[model samples]
Structure formats: C-alpha cells, structure tokens
Target: MKDFGKDLDEELSSLDAPPLGDLVGEAVRQGRRVRRRRAVGAVVGSALAVAGTALLLGGPLRPHSGGAGPSAVVAADVPSPSPVVRQPVTGAALLAAVAGVVPDGLRTGGYAAQTDGVNGAQVTGAQVYLTGPAGTGMIRVFVTSGESEASCFTTESCRRDDRGQQVVVDHMKGNCVQDVVVTSRHHDGTVVQVNVATCLAWTEAEGNKPTAPALTEQQAIALAGDPALSVWMTAEEGLRAKAAYPDLPRIL
Candidate 1:
C-alpha cells in the first residue's frame, strides 16, 4: 500500500529505450531493395512487350536456309530450232520453180540449159531470158548447182535470208540502165540468180540492148531465197534429165 503507483511508474521508465537509429537504417535498406526489385521487373516487362510488337507488325519469320533466298527465282526452259531439209529437182523443174514466183505480164524468151562435169561429178544449171510486156524491162533467171560467183563480186547491197544465206543485189550501169542482179547460195550448194535487165530501146531497135530488170530488189531477193530452187543440186535428177533429153543444148 505504501506508494505502489509510484513504484510502477519508476519501473516502466527504467526499461531500456528502443533503438531508434537501427530501426531507421533497417527501414531504409528494405525500401531500397523493393525499389531495385521494381526497376528490374519493369525492364524485363518492357523487353517482352517489344518482342511481341515486332512479331505482330512484320511478316511471319522464317528460319534462314543455308542456300539462296526467296529473291533468287528460276527461269523457264526454251525449245530448240528446227533443221532444214532439201529435196531433189531437175533443171526444167528448177526453171519452173523460178517461173512460179515471177509476176504476171512477162513473156518467156529463149533459155539455155547446161550441165558441167568434173571427175564424174556433174553440176547442172540454166539461164532463161524474159521479155517484158509493154516494153517495161527484160528479166533473166539463172539457177545453178553451186555457189553464186556474181554475189561474191559486189558488196553494194547485201542481206541474209532466214537460213542465214547471204543475198547480194547489185545495180549495174552502162549498156543496161537500172539493172538489178540478185544472187544467193543455199545450204545445199545451190545458187539462184535473178537478173532484171530493161532494154533502153524498143524490141525492134537495132543496138538497144536490155537495160534494167523487170523485178525490184525485194522481189529478186524473195526469188533467190526460195527453197524450191534447191532441186537443181540433185545428181540423180540431173542424170535422169540428161538421159531423157540428150539433144538438149548445153550452156554453162
């Protein structure tokens, strides 16, 4: 009973004071650890979001193959060219072939047919002169079994056929006015020549010889490029024709 309240108060005051400094330091360290963890979590979340955005915007990603990429495309196949085939023909047949291509209004004149032989190999050819109607011009068609000598002499106007044969068209002056000579060599050793010689004077004139040909440069080229003329190069046909027409005039 003697001063009990006072004794309790004294006892409470005597108890050890709490450690304020240690408690404040511990709280600060805990706060710093939580902030560092939040910062790390934020960085990881941002990286994942960027990856997802790229996947959404761009096309589907493909694993890289070791070789060429999609940009390297392949090409299609191309077909090969066709081969040329030649047929046999006689000198008369050769002239007929030439006659078939000539335009209308020209009259056929005297023709010279010849076959040259060397070591038993014969070369057949022909030359046919044509008189133009209405005194337009004179035309000559020459077919041979070998290359054209006239085509090699001039380089004035030259071209190539579909078979890559050279076609030479020359314009001559002097006795013949506006003369055109078209010559070409075929693949089968056949030469075709078309000469258009127009006479300066009428047919009755004394010394007025043929001037220019009746055909144009283009017409002559087309005639020379005809594959039907290759028949003159056939040995069998030439022999048969020679045997049949033994009295035929030989003019080479």
Candidate 2:
C-alpha cells in the first residue's frame, strides 16, 4: 500500500496539470470495502479520468486480513485513451497572428491558407508574400500534430526555448537560396514552423532573387511562438467548415 501510494503520487505529478478534485479522500473512504470488486473498479476508473492517461495498477496491495494470505498483483487491461479533439485554426486567423508581428517596412502580398479539398474553406496553416527594402520574400506558418522532429542541418542552429520547447533556426544564405526558418515545438507536441525566404513561393526556383529574407531569424522565431498561431480544429469542425464556406479563397 505504501508503494502503491507513492506510485500514484509520482504519476499525478508527471501530468501537465494537477488532477481535479480530492481523489485521495475518496480512495481512503473506499479502501474499507475490501471485499467489493466493483468499488475497486470505480476507484480505478476515477484515477484514469483524473490522470488523463492510462494508469498501470501493478503496485503492491495489502490483504484485508492481518495475516499474510497470498502475494497477488492486480493489473487491468484498459484501452488506451483517445487523442484530444480540437478546433482547427483558419487561414485568416493564422495570417492575422502573423500580421501582429510583421515589421513596419514589410508589406504583405498574395497570401493563402490550406483549403478543404475543392470547397475553398480554409483550415490550418497560412502563407503570405512580403515585399520590403531588405528583399521580396514570403512567410509561411503551419501547425502539425504529433511530436515530429528533424535534425538541424549544417547551416542551421538548434536551441531550447525558455518555455520548454526546441527552437531550430536556419538562415540559408548563399548563391541560390537565401531564407530564414524557425521551427518551435509547442507545449502539446504540436509544431509551429515559420519560414521566411527570399522566394515568393517555395515552388518557384527563379523567385529567390532577394539578397536577404524580408523577415529575420528573430522575427521568424517570434511568429512561431505566437499563441494565436498555435491552434487546431477537430475533424467535425473541419467537415462543417468545408460545407459551410464553399466560396472561401484557395490561397495555399
């Protein structure tokens, strides 16, 4: 029982947020019903909900009688929890987030966001063209689910942010490519990446004419860390938006 309590404490501490309600009080009251399997199940269920993750119950348990009976370890075969559903951020909203951080001299050009098939309703990610004295370039912002990571290239530098995220900066300056990229991993494992390149679009080989990127590495980092840009949509919301707005522009 001592070991079990310690395991529960450790597991709860590992969570990003504290568990809701006083589970300890409930567990203490319920522990007296030693013969009721249903009560044990209820406690386990509540623990799972509080943890927001699977709880392994391999910790030692004490017998109801004072005398030692059998050394038994109980384990439950609970299904893994589902991923959290979220509302996807629109292209316009993402662009607006970038607008707040844009430098004074840079003027935005044609911008687009990822659309839902042919319907035109945009969802997640945005790219905008920018023209300034430093050079003509583009800034693209996108959010990706899951914890995906790529090693920094030779021309790039990787650093850890104070907010507990990995920040990768790439300032590729040479004869052909001149761009600055900042990739920041969000707290929830989602990634917010900002790419500021001299090219109008990544697809255009000849568009990389500017000697320097319109936005600098620092600005790119700021854009990546913006709170508004770190949003997502659920599958149902995406489907509804796709049908609701057939006239949305296809910018991406």
Candidate 3:
C-alpha cells in the first residue's frame, strides 16, 4: 500500500506542473515587448532633443498682433542732419562785377584776378584794362585781409566819407600823364583801392595817353565802394578762376 501511495503522489505533482518549452516561449515574448518599448522611448527622446536644438539656434521670435501681416517696428527719435552751405564767390564773378561798375562805353582789354587762398591769403587783387574814346586805361582793385596803414601822399588828398571810409584821390607824380588812384578803407578793416590810370603796365602799345582815364575819380570811388570785390572767396571757386587766367599773374 505505501508503494502505491508514493507513485500516486508523484503522478499528481507531475500533472500540476507546466511544460518547460511553453515557459521559455512566454519569457521570450516578454523580452521582445520590453525591447520595443525601450526603442520607442529612445526615438521620442531623440526627436525632442533635435527640436530643442533648433529653437536654441534661431533668434527670439517677435510678438505678433491678431492681423496676418507683420506689425510695424517704430524706431527711436533721432536728430536731423544740418543744412548744406555754399562756398564763396569766384574770380570770374569778380571780373564781371568790375565790368558792370565801369562806364557804359568802356570796353574790357584784359584782366588778372585771384581768389583768396589759392594764390595768397594776404591780398585779393583784380585788374581790368578798359579802352574808350578818351584813351586806353586800367582799373585795379585790391582787397587786403587786415587793416592797411597806407595813407595818401598828401594830407589834402585824403578825406573821410559819410560811411566812415577813408578816401584818397591822388595822381601819379612821376608819370608824364597823371594817373588817378581812389583808395577807401572801411570801418570793418577792409581796404579797397581802385587805381584808374591812362597807362597800363602790362601793355606798352596802348598806354600813356595825355587824355583822362577810361573811368573818372568819382566812378573809381563808386567801384571801390562796391561789395562785389571782397577778400572772402571759396577755394574751389578760386581754383576755377585761377584756371580762367592761366597766363596772367595769380595775385596781381
């Protein structure tokens, strides 16, 4: 009886136990499911990292309104630029001024002029040779930067005008033909001297006539009083004027 009971117990236990192959198959399926989950997690993590990197590389995004179009960006206030300034007058312009002030019938023979800084800053000079029925003569205009101490040869010939400008009317003592010089010194330290003479130092063929000059002493004073002839001139204008009279003297 004991032998029979032992065999029965062994059979019952064997029947309750599961198959080894089925257990192995179940374990393999569980391992495959775990691996799949890990791979999916890794893919999701890599995609998130790439998106974060893109956001970091690009600049900060600007805020947008409800409208589809981009909003206008208003700039800060800034100061406006200064206005452009024009340069001073030219030598050719000065020559034209001289021509305008002289007598109506007198014709221009020759001229020599200079702008302020190109030739020299100390003296700005312009000389126009005029010829008319009286005789061929010259009109010289000189403007110095500073005050001139030049006085008349005789006190009787020097007098002050209403504008407080010293006026000098004198004749060339050494020359056979009397040449007149009208000098006016302004209160602003500008010295304008107008020389009207029958003789022109440049040309010997048409000068030294016994007749009066092309312009009279009164006309010379008026020409000297003209504001056209001044020491103020632009460098660029002076350069052009200098080229106008290439063969003539620069600061005569």
Clashes of each: 7, 6, 0
**Can you list the residue pairs that collide in candidate 3?**
none
Residue pairs that clash (backbone atoms under 3 angstroms), model 2? 86-234, 87-232, 87-233, 88-232, 88-233, 112-251
Model 2: per-residue Cα lDDT over 1-252, one tens digit each: 111233444443443321212222222223222222232221212221111222234433433444444543322333434555555555555565566567777887666565231112222456667777755676666554434344444434777666657677654333122245466766665566665645454233443234356676777776686555655555554565455443444432
Worst 10 residues of 3 by lDDT: 45-54
Q: After best superposition, candidate 3 residue 203: deviation in angstroms?
A: 4.5
As for candidate 1, its clashing pairs are: 89-231, 196-213, 197-212, 197-213, 198-211, 198-212, 199-211
Q: Root-mean-square deviation of each candidate, in angstroms? A: 50.1, 24.0, 50.0
Candidate 3 per-residue lDDT, tens place, 66-96, comes to 5544354322222334333323345565665
lDDT of each: 0.44, 0.48, 0.47
All candidates: TM-score? 0.45, 0.48, 0.51
For candidate 1, lDDT tens digit of each residue in 1-252?
A: 011233433433443422212211111122111112121111111110000111112233344445666654323222333333223455555555555566667775445454333223333344445556545454445444443332333334667877788776655543242256566767755656555555532223344354446676776787777786653334455455456545544331
